[model samples]
Target chain A: MDHQEIIPNLFRTEYRKIVSVLSKRFGFEQIEIAEDIASETFLTAAQTWGLGRIPENPTAWLYHVAKNKAKNHLQRNALFEGKIAPEIKSATSDLYDGDIDLSPENINDSQLQMMFAICHPSISQEAQIGLSLRILCGFGIEEIAAAFLSNKETINKRLFRAKEKLREERIEIAFPEPAKIEERLSTVLTTIYLLFNEGYYSVSQNKTLRKDLCLEAMRLCVMLVENKSTGTPQANALLSLMCFHSSRFEAREDKNGELVLYDEQDTNLWNADLISKGGYFLNCAARGDQLSRYHLEAAIAYWHTQKADAKEKWENILQLYNRLLQIEYSPIAALNRTYALSRANGKEEAIVEAEKLKLEDHHFYFALLGELYTDIDNQKAAQFFERAISMARTQGDKQTLQRKIDKFRPADIPD
Target chain B: MDQYLLLMRLDIITKEAQPSPEQLQVYMKQYHEWVAGIAAENKFVSGTALSTEGRVLQSDKVPIDGPFAEIKESIAGFITIRAESFDDAAKIGADCPILNGEGNSVEVRKITSVNENG
Candidate 1:
């Protein structure tokens, strides 16, 4: 591969590993120093690689350079002498050796440890995601900003504050104790879910979809599932939910980058592989007695993926949605349950339930009303469509609503 | 061929002035590109990028402890290249990556060789 492709791929995979190893060795307070050494290693590679061919083994070359840089840093800085020297002196008597021990197993342990460190409860959810994107996923500040639909300055400040919090809290790069594991893991799973949704739902300036963020979230989730301590039933359920949602990714948007309603979506585009994997994870999640919201949501997503659009499918979805709403009464889930109510019951009953929701400000509330009224009352449907269009924030949603409005003629309206 | 020394002078590097490590990697790539351009033209010579710390001395005085001094900008590092004229050497120095902003500059001067054989 060309340098353009090779360098970024390396950065994405190797950058975090180096940071993990260094942070693990130097302690959490010295993460910036670790990052500096990793950055310098890449910079030195850039400086020399231009004059000569890239080294035969680039990773090894980076490790060697970073090792030497860390050694030099330890020797030069008095700060390291005070903080790190004591730890090293205690761990190993050979203080001057400066090996920094980045073995394969150590590197894996460090990265997994960092995953927990970034999810410290002391950090705000926003800051946790910012740090995860930067330190764990190897995302740049610009990329993180784009993912969050914010500006660079905001993202930079968020990351700066997050790193400061990491230092202030003195969070170690290690797994939580057994008693705290479940709670910490929940925070991590929620962050991953939010990350995936950001990609799946957000509209990009240049592109209609931001699949990169979704893929990164899945990649991190896979890491969680692979590890013994982190692979909880809730995590498996989250992964299953993600897989089911991703299976329908191809049908979410049309060629013109317009949002496609579920009824209009081509079922042929759904990925069978992901659907089967989601099924497997959902089964795995069923092994436990405790029912998390993820289990309910994954069940809901699974019902949506079924090939048959019969009343049975809708009934199953409606039940799962009901259970989910009971567990977590989010307006979005209630709004969705209203749609399922229309499918399982009828539009008339669904209309009564949807109206009682009193979610007047939500565009989807109006959109759902518009959809429920389509065959029943064309005039009311047009009115609801108009309201939905005005309430919509994104161009894609507005276009979809406008298209629905276009189906109704003025003559069909009643004063 | 005349040997010329290009001395790079810049203000003390501060955390505010320095790009974060993530950004520095990108700048390093650009630096590599610029260096490669000069290397392709066969005008490149050996250069060393200096670390931040060193001792300083005054006439009839002992060496000082740090790089901080009275000067607004200190000589950061230097490179020697073969050029026929001062203008040619200056032109070569113009492409140096560290000549980045207002306070940073490259001063090119011809170096006198004291080789008796020559």
Candidate 2:
């Protein structure tokens, strides 16, 4: 890759590494200081490399510079002397001479710790996700704002408030004790799941294809599974669920950036590697007796990955969805179960169940009603499709619904 | 090769208003990329971002606590580079990543070297 390409790739990969390392050394309260030093380090690299050749070991160069910068910060700042210095002095008298541990093991530990710190239950779920994107995933504020479909001012205020909460709580950037990990693990898992869903099912027209966030969420889930303490059955199940969903990304969207429903999607576009990984993790998840929503969802996604002509795929999906509804009764999940029912039994029975849901404000509900009405009544189908188009939040969804409406009505309806 | 000085100034009207960290990150990245491009062309030598707070010396031999009240802009930083000519230096300044808005710009000028012996 060229300089431009390499810099961004490095930013995605190394930005977190450097920040985690510095944050570990400086302590969580001075995370901003760590971030400043990391940002400056990258800026220095860009400047030096712009005028000259990139270093042979660019990662090493960054670590070396960042390490020195951290040392400088500790020595110069009076705040560090009060809390961090005594520990440093006790650990090593000559902080400058000795090599501070930015080892692979330490780096992983630090990032995992930072993840827990960011996902503390005291913070709002939105704030936790925002922090994850900004601090853990190396996303810019603008990117985070786009992800949430909010203005920059709102995003900035949210981050500022979240950081203030972190400070006020005096939260430490370390893994909780073994007994306490489970208490916060569920929130962390939920945040990761939301992050993945944001990327997988974004509502914004401009940012419909943010595979970066999905990948980042997967990476964090992998981290959770790798660590002995955090690697529970649910974590593995979540990873498995993500792998199954991500495996279908290529087939998820059409050329016009509109979603292709599962039945209409080209199965050939599914990723074999990710599907296999999903199966592997699913098996890993099954080892325990505990069943999470992730397990049920992964099972549903897995069935969807099967051949369209398979006799049992829809049946299996319906079963999983039924179980999922019992475990976690979300309206969206209920709506999805109706789709599975349409495939498993028939549209006539599914429509009866779907109508009882009375999800009046949901576009997908109207779209599903339009689909169920297609064989029964063309006029009603067109009306439902029109309502879906009107209620749709994104241009892509609106276009998809509009296309469906167009097919039914030969004459244009007056607005 | 002739030496040139690239002078930068802050055009921001509200001196007390600090940039959010996000905005700062964006500007920092832009500045780095621009400087890197110049360095790739083998023009960059040395530069440093000046602190916003500084003293100013007046003609009356008094070091006033300023960039004075009347000053609309203050010199933020400078970088020295090797350029072929004044025109070449000016051309290079076009890409300098000063935060653009009302009056942000890089003033490029050829610098005369006084150390003849070297």
Candidate 3:
């Protein structure tokens, strides 16, 4: 990459490393301080590198500057805690690398610890995801706002309050105790799942890609799977499910950037490599008898990649969704299961179950009803599609509903 | 070749107005491109960046970190470049990214040699 792109990319990649390592060293209470030092180091780079004087070793230069800045900060702020982390304090100027080890393992370890801290249940879920995006993912405030579909001021205030809460609670950045690791990992996985879902499903366009959010979630999940202590079967299942979804991410959007229904999507666009990776993680997850919502969801997603409209695939998907609902009773999950029922059984049985859902406010409900009644009752399908069109929040969904409505009355509708 | 000094005075960023890391990266890219453009023309000489935490020494009073009580901007840094005239240096200064900020300015002056080596 050219120098123009280098620092920004580095900021994306190394900013988290430096910030996490610093937070890990000093704890969350000093996180804002750590961020200040990291930001200053990059600012110095921005100005110095502007003169076409990029240092021979850029990473080392960052380390050197960060080391100096940390020392300078500690000196200026006499109100700092009486004891400083010894590792950073005693290092000589030339031996700055000794101060903060930016080794790959260290970086991962620190980020993992931070993930757990940021996802702590003490804070609100929105704050947890916001902090994760900002502190662990190196996302800017504006980027976080785009991901959340909120403005910068709201995101900034949310983060500021979250940081204050962490400080107030004296939250530690160390990994959870051995006994609590499983419990803690559950919350972390949920945040990861939510993050992935936001990226995979959000309709907010123009700034941050929904694809990036899913990829970031997968990256975090990989960290959990790589570490022996945290890599539970559920984590593997979650990763597998994400891989399957991401494999078809491109297929979900057409050239004109319109949403494609799953059944109508061109199978040729599916990524074979990600599909196989998803299968690999599923195999890893099979090592344990402990089933999770993720395992069932992974199985459902696996069937989706088969790309066949066969009864066998639909039957297996129905079974997995069946098991999924028993464990988790989400209205969306039930709605999905009803669709599987349509494919597995027939439209009549699916329509009965879907109508019972009474999800009047959800556009997807009307959209699904429209699909079910298409073959059984064309007039009802058009009415349901019309209802969906008015209620759908995204233009993509509204257009898709209109297309469904158009299918019934080609003569009456204009092109 | 005549040497011209570009003295930069920039507005200080308070805590409330601190630029985000992403914003810093964006600014850095622009500045890097500008410097590279000058270097490509073979007019770039050398430059230095000043730390905000600086002390001003005076004979009568203890050193202070400031431009002055009345001044709202401080010397940010400077760069020297080969130029034919003051106007030529001004041409380069016109696009200096630092000047993007309010109250920021680049004062272009010719660097005159005072004495020859004995």
Candidate 4:
């Protein structure tokens, strides 16, 4: 078997199991050593497995190697201190009693515990996500540093210090208590969601979609859904929301790598399988009537995916946005809802609703407002487009707004 | 071929300066162990430990007791190593035992063998 294709997933899952077990056995301070040993194990397998047929059970083969690497690491440390444990020597010499718990359920539980530990709110949100990507997702410090546009040394220092703090505090590798689980779950879900978004809309020059991140997020959410103790209505809602959005992944971008907006996208290119799965998750999310923001967002996305024409879907989207505003009152939601209203009720009603939102500092809000006013033949609203052009961060966004401004002729200006 | 110095600077100011005699002995042992380790690894070159006392030689060949300038990073020690390139020298310098203690530093430099005698 081509181990390269399977190694990353195996490494992520197996490494977490090994680290969690070793951290419990030798204390959290030794987690770095565990990670190093785990890395060496994969390196060994990458070198060794290619020369011969892959083992009968690749996971078992990896675990055996990792366990031995861990033992060797401990023994080397002991030898460096001029002391060696006889039991460790015996265990290394005889691999009979070193059976690792490689069960899928056990592995998932360990990974979930590790995720919780990394996302502990006592740590900064930046540190939490950085550590989670490192420990749970198996992202390297250099990869994460690049993502945050920082140096690798800074990322390494942050991870080192964060782990030290967790060890000092004796942070246990277990799920958060029930009362605090809901609050903690939101942060974890947001991290995973953002990870998927980064993969979906990659900032890197190489490729747009980082399939690894998207798959990892989905796998983690699957773990959440399977666990009876932690699975909640919001978890299902977020997972469904991700699935609905990801269903359009195949059609989101064209052959030349240009983004195709949802209205212009080829619906035939959408993954029907993913759409069905998303629908299933949406139904699961409906079991609880608390109505999360994700639930409303998923409902809106489902409506868009189901509709054949943009004109038929605007009213439902507006209603979903109204419900979303009632649950989570945000300026972005109001701006979005108003845009939908513009398509449903005439430009005048949309502009009236949009004016109520004081979002002068937001560039896209001004751009949307300008577009709405321009549709109503109000050339005076070019000022908002000019403001948007000045505030725009990306060249593409700036160009788009400038084009809107160019369409407003001075001769047709309203005083 | 042109040559450049690969220097490793370390800060030595903090609350842990005034160590007990026993602690100083342990620190010395650790340092020596590190030095031996580097030597065994064949990366060690010429270097020395400096005392806290400040000394100077005047132009007239007279010894002078000097407080020196109020500098934060006083030269603790240094080492010389031969390499085909500056990168190689820097890699060798990275293993220097002088960096074992907290806030200690090891600076490396290339000796400019200019024909000043001519």
Candidate 5:
């Protein structure tokens, strides 16, 4: 590849590894210093590579440069005498003897450690996601801003505050204790899940940016799953859930680029490869007796892949939804279970259950009711649809509800 | 051939002034291209980046820390190139990546010999 593609690819892929390893070595207290060294390494590479002569092994070349820069920083700033301990004074001397130990093992270990570090409970969830995008994914502030539909100053403030928290907490870049691994991993996964959803259900209309967020989530998830220390069954299940959702990403929009509900999506547009891969991960997640929320969500997402509209599929989905609500209740999940109840039993049963939810404020509740009453009572459906359209938050949501209302006239409605 | 020294200066080296690393990586490609352009014309010589910390002495003043004395800007680095005239050298300096903005600039000076070969 030419420099354009190659340089950015390296920036995204290598920047994280270098910064992560450096941070792990220097400790979180010196994270900014590590970041500076990492950034300078790339900048120096730019000047050298701009001469149109790429180092034979660019990654190794980067490691060497970063190592030298780190050493120079240590000596130049006297990091040991003032603040940093002799831990680095000794760890860094190895660079002089040999290499900086950018081994695959060390890099992965550092990155996985960083995944937990960025998800510290001290920061807000949004800030955690933003920090993850910056430090772990090597996303620039500008790109993170575009992804969040936010401006640079806001994102900068968020990141600056979050990094300050990491320092204040003295959060170590390492895995949690075995006893608390599940709890910590859950937080990390929650941030990853939110990051994925932000990309999946975003309103920015920047398709590439949205898709990139999902991809970054997947990359982070894969990192967690591959590492033996943190790769719990729940991690696999979360990865499986992401894979299933990403497989249908392309089909979410129609020929005119309008949103396509899952029921109306073309099966051919779905990626069979990802669907099977999702299944593979789901099976991997089945190992061990643990049944986290991710397992339930993965099962739900897995059933979603059976696009043939079979009664058996809906019944299984309904059962999973019931269990999911029992474990941890969410209004959205409850609303979704109502739809599954409709498919599994009948519209009348679903309408009764949905009405009992009394989620009068949420537009999805009205939309579901509108869908259930379409054939039996077009007038009722129209009223529900009208409420849904009015209550919808975005122009896109209003148009979608309008389309749903338009789909069922006095005839041609679902049973 | 006359040798010209082009001193690179910038008001700021980082934070708001520096582009994102990704942007800088791509932006630095222009410097490579400029160097290639001059090298092809046989005018390129050498370039060196200055360390931020050094001792700077002014007339009848206590020596000051190198870069921070001038709060307005830093003399980042310099490059020497062979040119036919001051105009040619200045023209070459015009393409240096360091001169891209308001306070950022390049100062060009022709090297004068004390003696023929001293």
Candidate 6:
């Protein structure tokens, strides 16, 4: 009962099971109620369990308390109706009649169903990710709002609208049919991938990387892999890609937190455990005949992870980027492939590819172009750097570009 | 146990000021989809759509054709649904198509019941 004394891991395991069970029992439409009751149950447990030894079955205790809270809510509603109050009493007493199993299998299936329902394509992509983090990952609204780079009010409106749409559409709590699984899975994977991307390169300058978001994404990936129904080769590939990328976090930035280019990062700082795990998942991804975009991206990460030096892996990285581009062509991919080309060939080839992209409007693109030009001793590139500084959105990015411009300034200008 | 009124305030002037029939048709389609979707999900309660024609009853019991005030402040339609709490009602209101137009908004407020004891 004294949950304060309980270990964090134990509490989380028990809490997740209880929450998943209650969420399923109350229906997805009653998610807020379920979450409220779960929160209250944990609060009660914290007070009661801390006074004594932890319960032998902490999960069951939490579930029972939550069920009672839900019954109390129903009774309160019944009282408002002024009907037979005794009927509410009977309902409350019958809360424990059914033996609801909270096994790992049941919880995983229910959570997976909830994830698919929340991530339905009918909802906007922003709403899908926001709802998933809130309902499935148990994130607070403020936290989700921060992750979205918006104010809490805007996020509240978006979430309210998303839930309303879901209720209005009567979106079923079920997985996509076998034939449509791959397509639906793509949306789900994309949400998880973007979730991790936000964690890796946070939009907020104050917090470069939010470990909470990264861990939540990894936890969700692990859940996907656990459930046989939802697990697929692409899911494995995405998990592998996340692992590979996360492994380099220790070496991603210097002690002062400035961005360290891959060529300058110390290879010894990479986590070997994560690299092996990523390689294993990548192998699992390769089992399927079809190759997904995640597969190609993971291959690229794997090449970087396994190489002794960035210079040795340039050609492999370029090939992977080429394959990735063929799967899904985007401005970001083209930009990245240009960087790889710079490493493989020279600044000239990189400039050609970079110029082909009509991304003058993008600050980072121009800044990178300026860097490539600087590599080739072109003073005209200083103008591009100046333009990039003007277009830069963040103070940090602007400062970095300004420094680059000053470093490559013409001889005629005073230092 | 909180009761809420989902007020759908429509800017009739904006709708009437539409430049083309195609725009009106598109707006109509959106409303139709919304009603159908809500009805299918059983979220629809009692509601009514008002005609564009406006009538004002003066103090002298004279009825005049008028919406003398700003057209932006008019209420076109509304529906009331039973919900467990204010949050539930707000969630239901989020999907209302009344707020979809160029300059329209849906306002959700809890309805307070009163007694004559005071």
On a 0 to 100 scale, what is the lDDT of residue A48 in model 3?
Answer: 85
> Which one wins by TM-score: 1 or 6?
1
lDDT of each: 0.82, 0.83, 0.85, 0.71, 0.85, 0.74
Q: Which ten residues in a row have the lowest lDDT in candidate 5 chain A?
A: A90-99
The digit string of per-residue lDDT tens for model 1 on A350-406 reads 999998999998999999999999989989998888888888999888988888877
Q: TM-scores, in order shown?
A: 0.73, 0.73, 0.74, 0.68, 0.73, 0.69
Residue pairs in clash, model 2: A50-B36, A50-B39, A50-B40, A51-B39, A51-B40
lDDT of 1 at A168: 90
**What is residue A207's positional error in candidate 4, in angstroms?**
3.5
DockQ, every prediction: 0.00, 0.00, 0.00, 0.00, 0.00, 0.01
Candidate 6 stretches with Cα past 4 Å from truth are A1-17, A46-60, A71-95, A206-209, A310-312, A406-415, B1-118
Clashes within 3 Å, all models in order: 0, 5, 0, 0, 0, 4
Give per-residue lDDT, candidate 4, residue A155.
95
Model 3 chain B lDDT-worst window of ten? B109-118
TM accuracy, model 5? 0.73
Better of 1 and 3 by TM-score: 3
Distance from true position, residue B53, model 5, in Å?
Answer: 82
Name the 10 consecutive residues with the lowest summed lDDT in model 2 chain A.
Answer: A85-94
State the lDDT at A34 in candidate 3. 91
Q: Give the fraction of native contacts in model 2.
A: 0.00
In candidate 3, which residue pairs get closer than 3 Å at backbone N, Cα or C atoms, i.e. clash?
none
Candidate 2 CAPRI-style tier? incorrect
Candidate 2 wrongly placed segments (more than 4 Å): A78-99, A207-209, A409-415, B1-118
> Per-residue lDDT for A1-415 in model 4, tens only?
3878778768766766777665544556778877877788888888888787788888888878876766666566667896666655544534423444446665677778777777776777778767877887777677777666679999999998889888887887778898988888887877777777667666443342266667677878877877886677777877887788888887876775555666669989988888888899888878754677878888887887784656768988899898898777877788889988998887989888888887888887888888787856656568778778789775656765666676777765444
Candidate 4 residue-wise lDDT, B1-118, digit = tens: 2233434343343345656789779867866675676567565555566555566666897776642325545665555544556766666666655466566565556667421110
